[model samples]
Target chain A: MAQEFIQWLSHPGLNHFLIISGILFSFGIFAVLTRRNAILVLMGIELILNAANINFIAFSRYGTGTLDGQVIAIFVIILAAAEAAIALAIVLNIYQNFNTVNVDELNQLRD
Target chain B: MDLFTIVFYFLAIITLGAGAVVVFSRNIIHAAFALLFAFFGVAGLYVLLMADFIAITQLMIYVGGILVLVLFGVMLTSQVLDVQMKSGTIQTFPAVLVVSALAGTLVGIFWSTPWKTTAAAPMEVTAAKIGEMLLTSYLLPFEIASVVLLAALIGAALIARREKNA
Candidate 1:
């Protein structure tokens, strides 16, 4: 069993990348679910986006011979940037309206 | 282990460790700094995947542009540095339980599924091919993405701007 595990570690196949992406994705989810700050939540969203990008690049390299996954990853990156800009602007607005940046305190819309 | 495997392990550790810091750090400034390492590590992983162009783009756009903007946002906010910068979480136990369950399910699916794999081919310069595809096959998406970016820039500026009289 020990030798088998060593061999698995040395190969560094698709499953390894998948596992890394999975862990990153879960961490992002945890941050988004639990964090009170809006900006921190945005960072978690970025983490989720990066995890998806990793999965895309890994599959593109290992699975199909085409560059479709890479192309989609590029698009995803572009969208992520745009999303971050708009989200941060909204967060700034939130801060301006309320004295705090905490999501829990922004309960005025909780009708 | 071979050099490729060794490098992969190192990059994975850096990326995941930085990500943990980003998620769990108390100070927002420290989390932003940790995010820089996480983005850098992801760019390194991009190199390992042979997506050289995407790797460079990730470094340039993510590390250079968005992270700086995020840091500015964190610093410019009032009282961010003095006090109330604590990024506390509510219901941490439940969140961890849910996240762990989801991660386990994802890992199981990843290992059990039969992914289609092909032999590793010789590395070729992918930037030119990606550029060509952006122009030809994905021309519409390419143009649309630029337009979206333009709109986002304008919208963000408008939203964040303050009234002169106020």
Candidate 2:
């Protein structure tokens, strides 16, 4: 059974990519949930995006051999860039105002 | 088993291990830098998967562009070292429990589902094909993406700029 598992590991396939993506997605979720710092949370979000992209590319390559998944992955990358820019800017503003970037502490609705 | 499989395993380990550091590291700077390797591993995997265009894009945009931006965010916000740099986790038990459950379900689904897969995509220069698709079938989204990028650029600048009235 152990040798069979190793054999399975060596033969890379759709399921392998999916499992890795799943693990990465879980890591992102853990970061998003646990980290008090907004930047760390953003990093987790980036991980999640990467995980999703892996799935897309994997499906694109393995499933239909279509370029649509690759195209959509490109779009997703663009969106992630925009999101990072905007989110970091907001985090900076939050830091400037509150003197801290701890996400939970920035929870009050208004001044 | 083969050279390809070996490379895939190496890339997967780098991706997941670096990703773990990014998520679980106590130091925010460590997390930020660890993200660089995670991005690099993903790019390598894209290459292995024959998505050459996406792999290069991942390297250029993710490694060159976004990672730099994230590092800048880290440098600008955190002062000096040690005290403010520590990124502590909150509600650890719940996070672990929830994440483990989610991951287990995803893995179960991925393995159990008999995916419809053809032979691996023929290794080809995908940049030209992707470009043609972008211009033809994906034209609307292509144009809209540019617009969205413009808006984001302006918005980010507006938000991050020093407040003169303060």
Candidate 3:
């Protein structure tokens, strides 16, 4: 079993990419949930975007023809840029209104 | 092992390590820099996977564009007197449990799946072909992305300007 696992490890198989992307996505989720600062949350979102980008590139390389994977990756990049712009604007607004960018402190309407 | 496999493992390790840093770093600026490393590692993986166009786009967008935006946000909002705004205890146990479970499930799924290779290896499709498609068949989406960027630019400027007035 150990030898078989090593073989899989050394294989440039699609499974490796899938697993790596999944791990990255989870780390991003962890960052998003755990981080208090709004900027850190944005970074987490970027990480999540990258994880999706990895999946797209991997699929583009290994999957069937037609270049759909590349197309999807292009869209992901476009969306990420838009998201960053809008999110940063929101963060700046939060700073102006609340005097701090701590996401926890922005719960003014929670009560 | 073959060259491709060797390169894949190396890039994968780098990507994972940088990703871990992005999550675990306490300082927001440090996390942003670590994210740059992670993006570079992912681009490396893209190159290894023969997605040259995607690799270049990753480098251009994630490293060049998004990182700059993140750094600007970090610099603009950071407390100059108290740089250590990154707290220690936010969501500790739940994050650990969730991320660990996610990682385990992904590992299990990867191990269980059976992947088959193509009988004929993928042809060397050049970046020129990608450019050709971008200008031709995918022209609509490409044009749409440009308009979207323009809108984002105007929106960001508006938000920043609103602050100066208020």
Best model number under lDDT: 2
Instruction: Please state the error at residue A26 of candidate 2 in Å.
Output: 0.5
Q: In candidate 3, which residue pairs clash? A: none
Question: Candidate 2, after superposition: displacement of residue B122 in Å?
Answer: 2.0
Regions more than 4 Å wrong, model 2:
A1-3, B162-166
- Residues A28-99 of candidate 2: C-alpha lDDT, one tens digit per residue: 999999999999999999999999999999999999899899999999999999999999999898888887
Model 1: pairs clashing at backbone N, Cα or C within 3 Å: none
lDDT tens digits by residue: candidate 3, A7-109 = 7677767888888899989888888898888888888888888888877767666766446677778888888988898889878877876778887778783
Q: Estimate each model's TM-score.
A: 0.96, 0.97, 0.91
The TM-score of candidate 2 is: 0.97
Mind giving the per-residue lDDT tens digits that candidate 2 earns over B61-120? 999999999999898888855476787789999989999999999999998899989998
Highest-scoring model, TM-score:
2
Model 1 earns a TM-score of 0.96
Give one digit per residue, the lDDT tens place, for model 1 in B67-101.
Answer: 98898778766484477777788889999899999
True contacts kept of 3: 0.62
Kindly indicate the candidate among 2 and 3 with the higher lDDT.
Answer: 2
Ranking by lDDT: 2, 1, 3
Candidate 1 wrongly placed segments (more than 4 Å): A109-111, B162-166
Interface RMSD of 1: 1.2
In model 2, pairs of residues that clash are none
